[model samples]
Target: MKSMAPTRKLYQEIKDIVLLSDHRSSMAFEVSDEVLSTYVPVAVYWIFSGIYGLLGYLEGCRLHPKGAEEEENVASKLQVLRGVLLQQVVQIAVVTLMMKVVGDEGMAPQQPSFLVCACQFLIAMVVLDLWQYFGHRYMHVNKFLYKHIHSKHHALVVPYAWGSLYNHPLEGLLLDTIGGSLAFLLSPA
Candidate 1:
């Protein structure tokens, strides 16, 4: 142990310098992949949205320069976000239901090479976009859906990145959740 101490110190130093890491982690990957996968997307989505929101703030809201009444913007965004979150909960429930009903055979493990995985992801992205685009178009054309299911998304006269996700629960679910899940389902193997 004593003989290896110097080598360990050198390795730590290299990690700190070359990797730009100053802290050492005593923890391991103790969480199950399923647990991680379930929560990571929500966490990542909010975080990325926050960063983009911050950038928009810093850049003087160039993306959507129009200003709304403070109460209207805040309350509208809050209400929409609440509904969006609820839709995420429902999506999770739906996925759980499907898993129980259909079984896990569809998600059989894969040992694909990087190239194959990349190709699958590219195709999945295309499918996701198509689904969302068609769904969104449908919502716009349907008068009832436009008034009830998608009007919230159009509340903002002009939308910044932060406002991109401000929408009715059903609209968000139809476009974001379904599109994303379709992509995952298509490439899950």
Candidate 2:
């Protein structure tokens, strides 16, 4: 009989290869100067939105202390802080991948107008959302896995932007990997 250990190892190796390939393909598509320019404004919006969102939440908590539990507020704030840091890491990875894939190539196409960009962004967002939902469900179903990896995320009952970042490093990695892979795979030919 074929050894189960060898089979498992082989499966893992294949999974890694698929993940790397997906990442490479996505990076290649994203590396154009045009893509960078497009991505930058979106990134900036994300940052400002986070800041404003947190500020609003805090103000609300202060104005309506009875509506917000102290412990939940503290946990939400901590989660948001952690999320910002994690977002930075993700941005770096995305930029690095873009640089690698776009090397020496001319800037991405400037024409085809806003419609194309909008469609692309919409598709990417849809794929990412689906991936996150399914991946989160997977993490929850496995008790041992959930306790060790995803428990940190659930620590905040009242979530904030930072609550997104309050997860185990492994869980963070898994979420990103899954989302990225799905996005790449679902990209138009």
Candidate 3:
């Protein structure tokens, strides 16, 4: 077995550097890490959306400019927003179901070591990427899926941060929500 002594030492050094408190979690209110995990993704989504939205305003940062023929948006902002909202509802339902199924005992009280956490994150990324890749490819290859479902996402001519989440409700659930849930469940704690 690989010795965990070095890993523990590195984790302690990281804790000292970050000045993390053992008694307190990152949030101001007392909340379990398991519960906090659910909120983290939502927070990150908005944070990235904001960053990408800001980037859209910068000409130098844009891959395709506003006037480009190919970059024009076919779907209206309202349409995209509605799709996003619908997907969010589905996502919330899935998350609620997952939470209920897992219950309080799902997560351990002690946090995983930094190295372990990093490895888990890497694994999750690979799993999610693979899931998305195959799922998306399948959707494209299937005429019924592309026309009725995947095409909703393709309606956005110019990809923007806010529009990134705009997907058909079913497609979003299958490609994103299920893939994410699988990644979360499959990853070692």
Candidate 4:
């Protein structure tokens, strides 16, 4: 039908973006798209975290007095790092499982135009923000959650980039790993 022309064209453009002519040769060393998609975010997280961690050590760049911040913090830097590492391990397992369970399903088949991509990005941000807000609020409002799990993160009274992910294992699993996996699954991009 005449009405289908624009829809078909849009679909075609998406298809062009998503599907490669050759999956095996898509990358330099035959790395699959899925593998890159799976691990790149994880690698970037640690890389950026390390950068931030290093930056936090620069006394001249600090926004707050180190003595004041240190006085407020109940947990040690080592403890925070350990929590972050443990959470990252849990996140990797959850993400890998989720990817295996729903590989390429409902994803846009091709690349979208600039306008489309912009819209998708905005929508994804809003969705993720709302998801995080509600999840965080729920944890905060519940006494049990705050006392047992979320308290671990709150121990880091001095907020720093390196301590950003220092949450209890259960809280990290529920609030971050699952929320992020669901967000990725729900994203059309």
Candidate 5:
């Protein structure tokens, strides 16, 4: 008979213990705690991204000299900064919301026979990409609406992550609302 590897033995022991344990309810809590621990750093990074983006936008606005071309360039840089921050914020918010709403013991789906989580996640990426592309294109095509609604965003042409959030209320709402709605609609139940 071949000897079992240490890791394999350890895993078997753990599996046996879990099978014998009567504290099944606590298992869910443990899993949830582990998940939270893993994601906490990601959340922190997202907050930092927002802060840095804002700082970059401010710096660009202050340092760039006064001239139409210079101002436009600075604005463009700020917008890029803002875009980075915005993307991080949106990603974090969606993950946080999903965990909060669907991560409870009772909410977890039945155990799958095969690993499908990766596939589902990929689908989510596709949906988000499509939605963002369409939303941006829509903003560019409507000049009147773009001037009033999206012009403030253009003010930071020099985009940084921080500049990402410095947009008109309507633009903000439109982007967030559309993003959130599409994410929710496309998510696998």
Candidate 6:
């Protein structure tokens, strides 16, 4: 019985992290602790991407300065950045919703071998790459689809760091949300 105490405590701690506490609110959206926790890594991505993109831009524009003709105006870049931020908000919402749906069903760690975990991660990435390639290819081939959904992304004549997520909602959900969901779904956590 003494051995069960530590395992039980660990489970309880995980339960505290995964469970949703606020389902009722008058606001359009509420940022709960669970949501905030998930947002941290994504926020880090944006920060690092922005920094790298800024450096790249400065290098290209200052040192080499080749594509000045095609370089977009600051206003246009800001507009695209706004769109990226909006889509990130959508992503956060989708993640929160998925968490609510998946609940605590498979949160337990299986303590799989390093090789097994690496293999699962690799397989998941390959699947995601294939889906994204096909999904991206299809969106471009269909003009109507591109004009409606994918054009926003292409508007960035020369994209910056935050430009990574300037896609429209349709493309965003199909590419980002679905691909990521597939990876997590395939992995045993």
On residues 41-119, what C-alpha lDDT tens digit does candidate 2 reach at each position? 5477578757856675565533344345445654556555666567557655765575466444554444555777677
TM-score (C-alpha, index-matched) for candidate 3: 0.76
Residue ranges of candidate 3 with Cα displaced over 4 Å:
1-20, 23-28, 67-71, 106-108
In angstroms, the error of model 4 at 146 is 0.9
Rank candidates by TM-score, best first.
3, 4, 6, 1, 2, 5
lDDT of each: 0.68, 0.63, 0.80, 0.76, 0.60, 0.72
Which candidate ranks first by TM-score, i.e. highest?
3
Per-model TM against the reference: 0.67, 0.58, 0.76, 0.74, 0.49, 0.68
lDDT of 3 by residue, 70-176 (tens): 44778887787788877777877787788788656654567679999999999999999999999999999999999999998888877767788888888999999
Candidate 1 lDDT, tens digit per residue, 1-189? 358888888788666665655364333224534555567877877788788767766547455444543424534556656765786687676665645664555554657889888988998989998998899899989999998877777776544444556677767677887787778778755
Clashing pairs in 6: none
Question: Of 1 and 5, which scores higher on TM-score?
Answer: 1
List candidate 6 segments past 4 Å from native.
1-37, 56-75, 105-108
Instruction: Give the per-residue lDDT digits (tens) of candidate 5, residues 82-156.
Output: 554565566566666665665667555565434465665667778777877787788889998788877776776
Candidate 3 or 2, higher lDDT: 3
Q: Residue 10 error for model 2, in Å?
A: 65
Better of 4 and 5 by lDDT: 4
Which candidate ranks first by lDDT, i.e. highest?
3
- Comparing candidate 3 with candidate 6, which one achieves the higher TM-score? 3
lDDT for position 14 in model 6: 59
